[model samples]
Structure formats: structure tokens, C-alpha cells
Target: MPYKPTVVLSAIEEHHSDGVFTHTTVSRARAAMVRAVQAIYPLYFETMSRPPIEVSDLMARDGEKVTVLVHRHNNLFRTPQLIAVEGRIITTAKATPLGLIIKGHRNRGIALAPTELVDAVPGWGETAISALRARCEAVRALLPRETAPLTAGAISAIPDDTADAASCTTVLLTSTQLPYEDPVHGCLWLVSDRTPGSGEDILNGVLLAPPTSSLVSEHGSIYAGQLPPYTAHLPTAAALTYAEALDLAGAINGKDPSRGYLSALARLDAQL
Candidate 1:
């Protein structure tokens, strides 16, 4: 007898108006179809193995806070004159006698100031503040559905130029991870940056997979969105190291290594 495909069996099962076929016969046919497909495509039926390293996996294992470093860019200023931190873009406003007031739809047009606004323009006061509030709303709308709510906090702003050292900014970490299209593999990596663009430099755009790995770091350089001559941000305890970053890329590519340096680091850090 000739083999029957699932597509044909499914059609027959759907058009059983004649009531000549029994449920048992139909079930057997469906089962046979599944087996045939599996036999023909065993590779596709096999389970997709997990990567050696993943951001969530590392976070779960380490329980350490990952520091996402975002480079200040002009594109961020284009939308809402906002600053990116961790996973959010935020603007600062002063607390008036009434309270901290932000005029925008996201904040319901008025909100108590979380902290004193820094980098406040001198001449452009309320107008500037209102514009920023609007911008904040616009950026908020772009947030992915899986993102957590925007949480207010403080962050360190590292200047791109060596002449200027790191400064502090009272900002919010949206705690929301933005999805970036990795040009290299055409996969999606959740990155933290307020502005959208390409490049490895922190000043060029956003950063991904912290503690060592960045969207454009040499250790694991996963982001293909930006152009070449990729320069990575410095690695810190809060970010992925070069080896760990590579492992992460490997994992994303469905390559699981027996052991990764990140696991060793975690073990060493635990001992300390």
C-alpha cells in the first residue's frame, strides 16, 4: 500500500460527513501520518539543545546584578531628550511646591518628581520640561510587551571622551529589555539602550549581555546591526567576560559546550 501523508489524513478526518469512518481508524491514520513525517525528518524532530550560556541562565546562577552600559548618543536626544539607563529612557524634572509634575499621557499628565533634575537647561524651563515629558511618553510606547515597568533610580554616566570622567545621573532603569535585530545571525537579542542604532561603542548606541559581552564587543560580538571595526566596552563584574560572551553566542547558535569559563568564574566568585 502507498503511504499517506498527514495533510491528506487530516483532510479525510475533517470531511467525515458520510460517517463511514470510525474514530479508531481515524486516530490510527493520524498516528501513522505523524510517524511517517518523523521517519522522513528525524533531524527536525530532535529536541533543540539549549546554549551553554544565556543571560537568564547566568542571572539565575549568579544572582548578581548585571550592569548595562549605554553610550550617550545624539539619536536618543532626537526623540524625547531622554537618557538611557539599564533598560529605560528617562527625563528629570524638579519638585515644585505642588510636587514633581510631568505633563504627559504615560505619567497621566502630572507626577511627583522622583529626584531633583540634573542637566536642566537654564533658559528653557517649563517648555523644555514639557517637551521632555512628551518624549518620555513616546519612548515608553516603544517598550516591548515583556518589559517590566519603568523604575526610577540613579546611574553613572560614563563619558565617551577620556578627558571627561564618569558622572552621575538620576534616571530610571525601565528594567525593560529592548529587542535588537542581530545583523550577524538574524536573531534577536534583548539589549538595553534608549536609542536605536548600530555600533559597538557605548557612545555609538546600546549595549547587551553585561559584565563583559556587549552588542559589539570582540569577546562575543553578536550584534550585526552596527558597522565594523567593532570596539567593545570594558568588562566589569557586572558584565560578561570575553569567554562568557562567546559561550552565550555559542548557546544562541544551539551549540552547548561541556563547560564554559563563565561557569568557572561563577565558581571562583562563589568561593570568594
Candidate 2:
């Protein structure tokens, strides 16, 4: 007898429907079908490995406060396949009148934040869909998906209109680093941290006098969105130095270490 490929067993079954078939023939056919199914089943943890960004908010009705942050890790997912959008609203009690807060602190301090959504845009669902489709295609091309027949394309087919009614807007927060230079000048700033005295002290350079207005200033750094939790806004560089000084001197230092040395070197060069 000649050996035959496994798939031929199926054809044999079809031809020999009226004839007797051996158990071996049936078993071999079943095995071949199993192999074919396994080839396309797409086995991997690619789908489950995505960072889940889901929120569970708890606020009392008519007598509570809530602060939402758009970029906070709790409100963001790291997966590229999903879309993210951020939306914000301020709610205040008519009786006591405490406005809502939506905060994203550059510092480690708690930002009195307002609620925002990512990935789900309200009125701009079409735009969001377009963006996600383009993004998914890009992700598919550049990064190999662990699962073939990945449900990525299926996601794009999901209706964007449904996103509008979503309680919070969906924001798209990719795991990739944002692409841009720092908008705020790399200067030290004094921001409100809900402590008037502390805020004022930092602003007045009592805590740590930062660079001169010419060298560093806050032309467009502060935002109405950042009114609560009075914080002194300092540039990353300035903050590092201020933190170091505070750790050692317990105050902000304004004196430049290189000032006198640079002046002396310039004078010597002039004489030469």
C-alpha cells in the first residue's frame, strides 16, 4: 500500500460513503482537521496583556464632590488598539458652592482634578473612528500582533456614534511618549497648593527664589484649571534643585554657583 497525505482521508470518506471505513481512517481524518483548526486558532496572550484602564467612580447624589483627571493612570489604558479621549465638566453644589476639580499634577502632589474621559469623544465620534482606524493600521504594520486574525480590524468597525452617549469622553492615551518639546518654559514657577501662605511664599521666592524674570518667567504657565491644591509650579530642572536645596538647606537658593567664577574667568581672558 502507498502512503497518502492526511487530507486525502476526507476525500476518501466522501467517495466511500456507501463502503465500510476503518476506524484508523476516520481517526486520521479527525487529526488532520484538528491540525488545520489549530493553525488558525491564533494562540497567544497579546489580547490579554494590554493594560486595562477602567474607572469606577463613586460620588453621592446631590451632596458630594468629584475630581477627575484625564491623564491619570487610573483613567488611561496603554493599549494602542483602543481609542482614548478626555472630557471635563465642573459641578458645584447650589447650597455650599464647591466647584469641581479636574487635576493632572506634573508633580507628585494630588491634583484636585475634574472628570475627563479618554478614547470616547461625544460629538466627534466620526473623527475618533478615523483616528483609531489609521492608528490600528499603523500598529498592525509596525508591531506584529501575537494573534493573527487579530480583532483589531473588527474594532475599527465598531460604531463611533455610540461613544457620544458614553458618560465620560474616551481619550486615546498610547503607551508611547508624547511628541513635543515642553510648552512651559523650562523655568521655575510658584503655583498654588491650596495653602495661601505656602503658595505666596514660593511665589515671592521666600521658599526658593528661582531665576530672574528674564532668564525664567511664567508668561503662560498657570491655568484656571490649576487653581486648587495650591502648588508652586516649578520646572523639572528647577524643581530638582529646589528639592535638593530643601532637603539640605530647608529653603530655596537663588545664588548662582557659576556667577563669580564666570566673571573672574571673563576678566582674566580680557586681560590676556
Candidate 3:
């Protein structure tokens, strides 16, 4: 019933496997929201090919159960708009023993019937195919991404980056020791290639990583792979992609940009 909120909510739902509350600043999730609106509400809203500047304020106006709160180190950066379509978007392909699918994506795939099952249940494949076809037909009705005008309010909605930067207070009790958890710590990067607020293609990034030892950034880094200066406990400036950030964050650490930034803030808040 609700237009914009549904779109926004759907986009957030698409990427979340763990069913957690998502923030407005996540660009990847927001991009998915952009795509969700296009797919679901095509007639009223043109399936935008480009992302917009301010979907945040729109939700506040639109009738939806929206909540507001601020974290210590609040930021809403977006990852790229990859994987818009879910495993629900099915395709026919050959699956292999090596867990690879050929010709088509077999992500979250299903086989009509295994060889023995087809033999044991003669009409099973036909019945399964028929049902799947109907389901896919229903899916075809909804699917699509893109643009809206830039609003002045949207510009204002962006937090005062200068103030946030100025508030960077990393108290080093001992100058000889790096304050952050050694071997790995927090980081953020300014990826100009990404869409700012309304960008479907881009969002800025946050990271919790050790000094860049071996990880390589997708767009590379302003500091190559080394740690940036004066970033001991504050989010420092650099260039990196979500994947690259995650890589540097390592397999054990969490990879969420929003949560990552919050954690960075929480750590610094203790000293203050």
C-alpha cells in the first residue's frame, strides 16, 4: 500500500541474511531499494536507471513505520549495486560436481528431479517444471532500478563531515604504541567513483582493518596498502571498495560498513 517505504524496505530486505535493522546510509542496500521500487512499482514510478540523491527524507513523509536514532560514529555509506536480483531470479544451467554451474547462474538453484528420482517418479519432472514455470511467470511481473531529482533538504541531510572530522579524538596514552587494536583496526575511505547519497552505483565506505599488509583495494588506495597518517582512532581518508575493505578487515572480522563505522566510534568514545 505504501509506495516509497515499501521500496526502501524491500531493498533493505534483499541483502540482509541475518535480518537486522539497516540504516539509510548503506549505499548497496539503498541501491537495492532503488531497484526494488522499479521492479515493484513500474507504472507509477518509472523504473529509474540512475539512483537518486535523497530517499531518506522521502521515507519520513511516506506512511511507514520508520524509526530514527543516532549512533556515536554515525555514517551511511553505500556499497555498489551488485546482486540486485536474488537467487529467486532463476536460470537454467548445468551443475557440476565441482560445485560450479555452467552457462547460467545456479545460485540457490533446484534440480527438477535427480536421475534416480525421475526414474522412480515418472511424471515428477513434468509436474515440477510446470509449477516452476508458473512461479517464474509471476516473478516476471515484477523486476527492475534509478533516478530522482536532487533536493536541497537531501544536501542538508548529509551530516556535517567537517564537524565529524574535527571531532576525531584519538587519545594516544603512549605515542610509542598504536592505540588501535594491533594487527587490525578501523578505517574509512573516500571513493569518489561511488554515488554519494542518491547514487545507485556508489556509496562511501567504512572499514575495520589492520595496517594494509597484503590486501589490494578495488580502486587501489591513496596510501597504496599502508596505514594513513593520523588515523589511529579516527576514520581516516583513503580509497577502497567494500570488498577490499572486507579483505583487509580479514575473514574473522565483521564486514559491514555501517556497523564498522559505529564500532570505530564506540572505541574512540571510551577515551572521550
168-209 per-residue lDDT for model 2 (tens digits)? 111110111113621111122222121123232111111211
Q: Tell me the lDDT of candidate 1.
A: 0.24
User: TM-score per candidate, in order?
Assistant: 0.18, 0.16, 0.19
TM-score pick, better of 1 and 3: 3
Candidate 2 residue runs with Cα over 4 Å from true position: 1-123, 145-272
- The lowest-lDDT stretch of 10 consecutive residues in candidate 3 is 114-123
For each candidate, the alpha-carbon lDDT, in order, equals 0.24, 0.23, 0.26
Arranged by lDDT with the best first, the candidates are 3, 1, 2
Q: TM-score of predicted model 3?
A: 0.19
Task: Name the regions of candidate 1 deviating beyond 4 angstroms.
Answer: 1-156, 159-237, 256-272
- Across 1-272, the per-residue lDDT of candidate 3 in tens digits comes to 31110011222223544679533433332333233222222111122332222223222232222111101111133221211111121122352211111112434432222110100101123343344333323322332112122233332433342332322111110011234522222233322222333422222333332222322222222321233222221112232334544454343244443333333323433322
Q: On a 0 to 100 scale, what is the lDDT of residue 8 in model 2?
A: 11
Q: Clash pairs of candidate 1? A: 51-251, 71-202, 100-113, 210-239, 210-240, 211-238, 211-239, 211-240, 212-239, 212-240
Best by TM-score: 3
Off by over 4 Å in 3: 1-94, 97-165, 168-272
State which candidate, 1 or 2, has the greater lDDT: 1
Q: What is the lDDT of candidate 2?
A: 0.23
Which of the two candidates, 2 or 3, achieves a greater TM-score against the reference? 3
